[model samples]
Target chain A: MSGNNDYTQIDNLLREDRMPHIWCPGCGLGSVLHSFLTALNKSEVPLDKVSVVSGIGCTGRTAGYVKLDSFHTTHGRAIPFATGLKLANPELKVIVFSGDGDIGSIGGNHLIHAARRNMDLTVICVNNFIYGMTGGQVAPTTPLNARTSTSPYGCFDRPFNLPKLVTAAGATYVARWTAMHVRRLEKAIVEALLKPGFSFVEVIAPCPTQYGRKNRQSTGLAQMDYYKENSIIKHGADTKDVDIDLNGQIVIGKFVDIECPTFYDLQTEILGKTFPHMSKTQAEEASA
Target chain B: MSRDGQLVGEFFMNGDVASAEGAICAGCRFFAGYPITPATEVAERMAERLPEVGGTFIQMEDEIASMAAILGGSWGGVKSMTSTSGPGFSLMMENLGLGAMTETPCVVVNIQRAGPSTGLPTLTQQGDMMQARWGSHGLYGTIAIAPSSPQEMFELTITAFNLSEKYRTPVLIMSDESVGHMSEKVVIPPMEQIEIFPRRKPTVPVDEYLPFKADADLVPPMGNAGEGYRFHVTGLTHDERGYPDMTAEAQDKLVRRLLDKIELNKDDIIILEEDGIDGAEVVVCSYGISARVALLAVKAAREEGIKVGILRLVTVWPFPDQKIKEIAKKIRAFVVPELNAGQVVLEVERCAGGAAETILVPHMGGAVHDPDVILEAIRKGSK
Candidate 1:
């Protein structure tokens, strides 16, 4: 099995028996998974040490396909679940991979709080603009005036600028890339994986079956072309200035990177100072 | 260094505090909860003590997140628990179903208070008894243990953790506000004397392991998140391999196993205490604080030369149906007194199966039953 030519590199990281996956033909989720696999392969962290968590949605299925310790948690709960996983075993590299509605709308509170605490988690959010799995419901990331199942008249609410949300919430590292930018997205993922504190990467992906068809980008290829034409690589750009518009210029780049003490570090420091007589492990163990 | 060793001692404390200590003694190392009245002391105690014992205590944004965190913590290879009262318990229902579906081992302590919607935050009520059994949406079996006093709260919380680990399901410590806030002497036995059931881990190598495959005992060996087992856990109906299988057949198989894991083990899970039940004319059935009150009523009835017995339910769910059936054959009737208008009495009535008359001495929350009222019911049942 070691020298087998039958298996592809990406295939080694996937649950081959579980494929072909549930994703529609030409869905951007496939590309996102590929980029994640590529990044995992490139990173120095051991695959065995990685744990992936996801909330309910089309993207939530990513945890099921990945041949790693993964949790397909309840809707709007991936971040908190990952927080618990990481805090319980600090050695594990916990990552939350879910859709826009999952991470931005219902789970928005956890996202901000996890980022605010600077919990060491890698959050890879696939922003498909609409809630694809629930049949194209309007999401928090649905661009203004966009058509959705719920918003047949057009979405009137302004969409959240995710990079700005996490930046303000105190994420140490943040970046954005399109699913079509496979190489760049993979690189961003690798960088996010290696970063110390809470890191977030927003991947702008097409939901051809849901968002794309409803909005006039009809085919996955058409959405990819739009991404290619509209995306502007703006490293160090202000997150607040990167709000996406329908078929408009998509500002994509690494926007924030800084150093700060994480939740675990601060907690340890406080416990150590408070209990001077106890060893670090003992102090940590006292709560168990 | 050994936190478990430090747990052996006697202390006079409230039920909520004793419960937190019980969780630690039971080898629970992770606690995630939101602070709610009556149950908040459990979280406060955990926050103060967990770090000292090499454990983790996290106060999540809400009960929903708290429930999710404990499930994640369990998968991360820790015995996890969370506590809440009525409102927070309601918020935790959805994720509680997820825990059941995924077969995660964790404990949920509901220091129950009066509620249709937070009617009485500081008052005692067994109103959430039915909710604990069926709060989470689905047809599933659940384990809930009722503790009558602070000492029982300490003892039964450990039982809750042990049962959760053994069955790989969420166990509920269905304590009420009266017991939660009341102080009493609780003796923590030496660590070695207390039996703790740790989750079963897969013996097979990573390649051969199936995440949802159950042994003859109807429980799957759990694989920790970062242990290289690389298993997938989902709330969706899944095959033994843990991959989603959305078919009626798959749902039937998965749901049945989830139910059977506890149902088949019902004999072991049901815990009840009885006094003077043999050859009794009337048996008073009750649980939680009401059980203590019912015992006094039984004593009053017996003093009046009435043949009455007391059936105290320690494990409220898995409902002691067999015991009720056996006792119903010899008894003329059952008198159930509860804080709620009617809850567990329905279960007693169902199990009696017309062999005996079932009477409910109802109380509309905010207080325990007056012994005279239950005594009246016992006297009525005897006649």
Candidate 2:
């Protein structure tokens, strides 16, 4: 396989409509999409074998852009669609990309279920703190007291700690990185793609046009600077220490990793005992 | 002829068990269903027989999961099925559209009960006739079958599986509680005589295969997951490669084919049975449990010095319009008897071309219409 350094092939995989994305001039979503295409290109995972699934919102358009088998589904429902796709043809590499609104709010149940099932796929959630497509509405992952179209009185509800949520929901692999950490984000994407079970990487991207302007942050470039200043290099940070608000909060790194059996693996085990020699492999061969 | 020309088989069973036996005989090996009344027997029987035949059965969390799981199982290279009643079938609509858009082949058995919402769990009604055709939110077509007996349930279940595979669309087996709970003799066919429909597999090299590229037939050959024929699938209107493209042109092309694939070939997909009516002035059209009663009414009407014929719709959707039109010219009037207030009756009227007078004979939850009520409609239409 070719090395990751050559990004020329990645250009071929970028979607045309998704060309000038809706992200802020320097928004991390672009970097994430770039890194994603890079991983697929570098891994030489044939574009034909990949099926990208996304939900409604700005990031949801990734499905439309990706030059592969993609499902641009309804809001927050991308996981279920991806779950169906992966379960149907385990050979297809299923990846889900969406915004916080898509993943944490409408699709929250599917996220938890997919995590618990430990489905073999990758989930890339671009956390921009607020809904961008609906013109900066307060999102489920919006920071405490953040101002937005929906939360004029400031978001009173505490936002979700997404990594912690998935960790508790039984995701086998969890990682977090900011938009400015392009190399780290790209590596995470590559690792998640290779992981045999459910892998989640919550990329904290900056919506300079919406959240950044409302929160009184600098331009998109300056927001990238904040990500650089705030993030620490520790890979094993405690969940309690990672915080997105005032007082003491460390932007957490890799938190939990366990080896619980995935839904399909355990499913095949029960099936093997219940119906000996009825494995899908045998059935497919016989049918052929 | 064979030594046993009549061919012997008989058993007392409920509607759900009969449907499950039908699926098994049809070569269905993957089942995902959450237990619901009047439909639970189908799932239970699958749990028992699917294992014996080296097939798999899963109890999903809900009907939505059941629908999604079956879609997955189908793509995973198995003939998959799910059974539910009205409430569960209602929950399955969203994903049912998903199956339609993705063009996945699977069987969904709706053993209908009385309901606006769970009106009668143990009773029968055919209220979901329209839902079976248009419950999903989209412009896709559906193939629905209404079986009147345990024997037809077994036979049509196989036919549903075969049609679904042939067209790469979801097939609906709409059975009411009356037929689901009732039992009579159903012959179990010998293995050699049973006809099974397998989905078309890709014959081209793995690299050359495009999952959604249509051949002479609108259906492209499908490759099972994990078999190395890598292809993408999506819910968006997409090109033949299964990649999402956001353009009016793309949507127009894709949606047209999705609608045309079934519409253009309606003749190949529609199935109905006709009785009497060579020189009859009136005809009765019905399906499911009502068809059984209609059959009896047709017999009784003839004995009572009235000329009446029966038109039994084996395939409820694609709605048998051409057959109805042909019969309309021969008959002076049409009578449709159904468990619902009026569903298929409306379709019968629309397709009868204003030539035949169409009358609706409606029944509600848990109630089977008296044969005399249909006889009256026949009498009125005959005159």
Candidate 3:
């Protein structure tokens, strides 16, 4: 491999030929993917044993671009797929990356349950607050009264407080950061990668063509400026206080970081005692 | 006992339990499912056995997740499976389609129940024959097996995993609630004796590996997720390299091959039980629980001096088209007895091609057809 052809340090970690990605102009997914690859590099997690999974949406495209063992599964089904992957092969580290609509809406049940069961996975939810791939439809995380193709009259329903939901559902590690905080995003991902149990880092990204255009933050810079002006980092704040409204102060920080027996720990503890001669694989210590 | 979880001695067990044991014997190490009537025993049995035999059994939130997880498990270097009844089966269709598209090797056991919206949750029905064949959105070929009894359930669950592994696609065991609930003797042989088909591991090196590229047998060997293969698979149409190629040509190539893998191998995949079909005037064609009923009916008709035969479909999908067409030439009529109105009969009729009269002995759930009803149909068909 010629160093001259390698454009970036993390180029080895990505499918460069697949780039010029599908994310539109000024979309924040590019920055998010960069930070993710950076984290994967710095953490030194064996890329061979790392399987990246994603659901449908713009963010879901991350699985395809990653040079790791990847699976671009059906819409809203990435969590379950990752759960199976991790459980079936306890040695592999599974990561789920998808959009707000994919994880917060259609896959809401799976998201909460994975956290509840404390499945060993690092979930990176790229929340642009709109379904950018499908022409900017209203998302579950879209602010109430936000304009979208579907919510033309404005969204009447309240949006999901993702951080609060996952924390309550029992995530051992949880954090939120916008795309502008690339360094911090990369750091948090590294931390989440190191931490076992269900680790979630929600990356608030920009959808220039969709959410930004509809919600009046039309350009990618506009969304970054909003982040620049309104962002407040208060570590360990009450998750309930982190809900972001339209043009609201973006409370971005590590919200929940605690110790808990993960799905594997509990499985081993409980099953090892009962089935004295059980196998050492992930599924060996399971049942009900 | 030496086989760890394989029970070789004769034991009276329900078909559901036998299936769970069969999965264990067939090298399935991961099971994920949700509880549903009649089929719940399969999950219950799996829960007890998987832990004992060093496998994973998870009760997922629902069937869709159950199906998705199994696919994930399969890629994670374990043979995986999920079992459900009617409602759960319908919920699983989307992911099942995804499983087919990605060519993931997994087994889905749908213990048939009455449905059209939970029609008869506690009862048996062969209602999902068409759904099993065409429930998924796109045009993809399906491999479905119909187990008639507890013994067959134990035997065929192994076959389902073997077929799924051989083809690198999800295989369905379409047994009804009656058969799923029936208790009978299931003799599991020594593990060394059972023909086990391991996952086809990729022969090519990592850089040269194309995850979706078919080898000589039209099935690309699979490489596990963490093996440095670093391959990608998607629900979208993809090329040989496992990268998405959004074009009509790409779709045509992928779908046709995804289909031809099973279609071309139909002779190897299709299993049928034919008795007296060589010179019978009328053929009693059936599968699953209905086939059990059709057998007695055929016997009764024979006593009445009617020339009839019994053709029980063991492998329901890739539907014994050639065999059906061949039999149609000599038979006066084909008597199809299914718990549903007419599902597989349509395929029988299509294969028969007006060569023989096609008669459907239909039952609309809650119960199996009486032998007398099928007997009357067979007697009339022969005349």
lDDT tens digits, residues B149-209, model 1?
9999888999999999899999999999999999999898888888988789899988899
User: Which has the greatest lDDT?
Assistant: 3
DockQ of each: 0.78, 0.30, 0.86
Tell me the tens digit of each residue's lDDT in model 3 across B71-130: 999999999999999899999999999999999999999999888887889899999999
Query: On a 0 to 100 scale, what is the lDDT of residue A133 in model 2?
Result: 85
Cα error, residue A56 of model 2, in Å, equals 3.3
TM-score of every model?
A: 0.97, 0.88, 0.97
- DockQ, candidate 2, comes to 0.30
Candidate 3 residue A107 Cα shift, in angstroms, is 0.3
Residue B120 in model 1: shift from native, Å?
0.8
1 or 2, greater by lDDT: 1
Residue by residue across B86-138, what tens digits does model 2's lDDT show? 99999989888888888889999999999989789988899999999999887
Ranking by DockQ: 3, 1, 2
Model 3's DockQ score: 0.86
Which DockQ-derived CAPRI band holds candidate 1? Answer: medium
User: Candidate 1's residue-wise lDDT over A1-288, tens digit each?
Assistant: 113432226776799988888999768999999999878877757788899999999999999999889999999999998988888888899999999999999999999999999998999999999999889999999998899999999999999999999999999999999999999999999999988789999999988899899999989999999999999999999999999997899999999989888787777778878665333542255356
Better of 1 and 3 by DockQ: 3
Per-model B-chain TM-score: 0.98, 0.96, 0.99
What are the Cα lDDT values of the candidates? 0.91, 0.80, 0.92
